[model samples]
Target: MRNTRSVRTHEPSFHQSALMDLRRGGKFAAVFLVLVFGAMGLFLVAALVIAKQSIPDRPAIASPPAEGVGSAPPSGSAAAATGQDHRREQLVRFLTAAAHPGQPAWRTWMPAKADTSSAFVYTPLSPADPGAREAGPGATARVRPSALTPAQTASMLEAVTRRGSVRPSSVAVSHASGRASGWTLDFVVRTSGGNWLEGRAAGSDRASGETVLSQLTYRR
Candidate 1:
């Protein structure tokens, strides 16, 4: 009797080997593409960080006012007040010198160095009587050194005797209107008779912004 069981033979075929190789190649290509995309993403992130660090901060500028509106600049009143105060102090010094008999007090009221040709006008009055003649340029150079008359000398001496030393604390300064640019200084001194001697000094601080004495008058 013939054997009815059939025996299977094992063998490698080119078609099956080619199919297995193709599957392995496809898996490797997928892995390589994934790695390439991941590296590209990392490089992009790094480049963005470097660019951010290279930029510098900038300062903010103020915006200008709208059209037709104006921005207020710094006021000159403060500077004017300061200049007036300084001039007041100078006038006080002049008054102090005038209290003496022979000192050229008129010179003190003038600028240390005058740069202008404007004539200075100085007028000295007496406390004894209003009829006393005013002394200054064109009338008499009594404001100069050794130019005081016997009566004027006596009047100054009597005033000093009646009034104590000048008090710079009582000096005051005011602005003069109707002039282009000028100021008025008011001076006060305490008297032994408990009275107050008043003096007014008016002048133009003009001539390239130089302080000068143009007019000075004193009364009791």
Candidate 2:
């Protein structure tokens, strides 16, 4: 008999193979879950950014003006007209007070350095009458305008002032035309005694930039 050597091959055990398969399956499952969750998170973040970009920005709201306040100040001719009206009102108040020195209500209206010595002219024209008509070639000679003495002007102003005092609200002033220089103001005063008294007062600036009364007239 020849000497024979037999070689035995050993196969892996069932327990070891099962353990290796379990570890491989666990690793693959973990990697798949991680990829799925990461992709979903990135998608959600991108959707949020896209939505925010698509929305428009809102505009700012303007606040409203306060009570009794206007949107804008008066300008141009409107401002000038407003100033002129204020000056005329001041003149009316001044004249009203000067005409009646005895009235306590008008005392506050008189200025400290008011000058009333200037010449005052009188006319029969009504305060409501339009500007003087131009003289026609054949028209009769117009009567010359008369100057009032200081005493007469004072008396006339007193009468007119009394009329105005009866109803202070009835006193109104307007612009008088036909004056070449300076400003002429026409005023109407209603009295309880009888007809309304109409008057005209003119003023001009002096060399010292002070306003001085140039003329005045009043009639029933």
Task: Name the candidate that leads on lDDT.
Answer: 1
The residue pairs that clash in candidate 2, if any, are: none
What does the lDDT come to for candidate 2?
0.53
Query: Which ten residues in a row are the worst by lDDT in model 1?
Result: 136-145
Candidate 2 per-residue lDDT, tens place, 6-122, comes to 987887799999999999999999999999999999999999999999999888787887986686787766765654565456556655565564444333322223434333333
**Could you give the C-alpha RMSD of every candidate to the true structure, in order shown?**
13.7, 15.4
Tens digit of lDDT per residue, candidate 1, span 43-76?
9999999999998868888898788566565367
Off by over 4 Å in 1: 1-74, 110-131, 134-165, 174-181, 186-189, 206-210, 218-220
For all predicted structures, in order, the TM-scores are 0.40, 0.37
Where model 2 places Cα greater than 4 Å from the true spot, the runs are 1-76, 102-117, 122-156, 159-168, 176-181, 205-211
Per-candidate local distance difference test: 0.56, 0.53
